[model samples]
Target: MITIIKNKTLKTLALCCALGVNFALSGCGAGDSVQAQSNPSTLATKDLSAFVNTFWYVPQAYTLAYSYSSSTNPKTTAVSDQTIWHFTSANGGYLLGCSFTSTNNGASWTSATIVGSVTANNTVSLGFFGGLVTVGSGILTSSSGQPAFLMQMSSGIASTGLTHWAYMLPITSSDPSWSSLPATNNVSVPTATASGC
Candidate 1:
């Protein structure tokens, strides 16, 4: 009888362990990585306009990229400068493909995909915190029957009156590929409607 009880106790313990792991892995407080943003390095301290482009559409539904510079010159990723990729999904959700940290002010780019929500609206809310553009959220409304889309951000480092920015660039596919992407100067400013998200 003792042997049977021992076996049952072990089984119960194993089940509990599995449950705990599953809970941790689940998407909770997933607001643009509400958890990961706890790290001070990933916050968007730059203007975020250096990498923003007010385009009409994301051609081919390609992924987008953004980079931040803590100083006119940086030599380490820990100085709090970060790069993020905005990935569009077929499921109508957006994400960061990988993360890049630069102490060199992006002298050479590396791969890093810090997960988070990039934008949101009353109907669709997406993005994670602690992202290079964590405080930056926007609306992505595509044209009817066309890939042409309009992106508008409620919060950007530039909006907060800063020079350096966390802006966007195009990556490979609309799919989430964590390869490499470069920031762009092509980001533009467009007339936008108020964010209702």
Candidate 2:
């Protein structure tokens, strides 16, 4: 009886140990699965600088069409005929400034400013300048004399080159707008006088 009882107790202990080991191994497996699911593309700051240095001109210009929602039922309106200027640094970071004319309800406004920055992946954060009237005669200045809209770009930077780029602008707290446009990649090279604008 004693011998049988000892063997049974030993078997129980061994079973518990096996269970513990299995649980530990399973836990590690689960952790690895979670890590895999969290994978995201990331670029270091150094890589961004290298990408920017390759371009001769950091500033470029493009035409953009901007659309926005109205206060009433129509919900949206688009303004085309806008000019945008963009600047990029050596680290693949960029800034854009834009101006345009807008007409609503027979009232016309001639200028709007959008300022923002971007990363190599074309991710953008944008802020809009909301207060200035297009036809105002007074000197317009913010109380703080700062830009009204500010934006930053965070994704799609790697896809940008000398001729084309993907960009984004934050239109509101909940909405971000994106665009693609033509760019002059090589500013150092001389071109025909007709190409000058």
**Number of the top TM-score candidate:** 2
Compute each candidate's TM-score over C-alphas.
0.26, 0.28
lDDT of 1 by residue, 85-180 (tens): 433222223343333333243344333333433322312233333333433334333354433223332223642311123323333334232222
Model 1 misplacement above 4 A: 1-96, 101-106, 110-112, 118-133, 143-170, 173-197
Per-residue lDDT, model 1, residue 129, is 39
Candidate 2 residue-wise lDDT, 1-197, digit = tens: 01111123556545434555323222322112111121146553123342221211111222233334434344433323222322234323433334332222112333334444444434444433534422111111122343122222111123221111212121212321112212322211222111221
Q: Which ten contiguous residues of candidate 1 have the minimum total lDDT? A: 188-197
Q: How many angstroms is residue 197 displaced in model 2 relative to the true structure, after the best TM-score fit?
A: 21
Best by lDDT: 1
lDDT of each: 0.30, 0.28
Stretches of model 2 off by over 4 angstroms after superposition = 1-32, 36-42, 45-83, 86-92, 101-110, 132-197
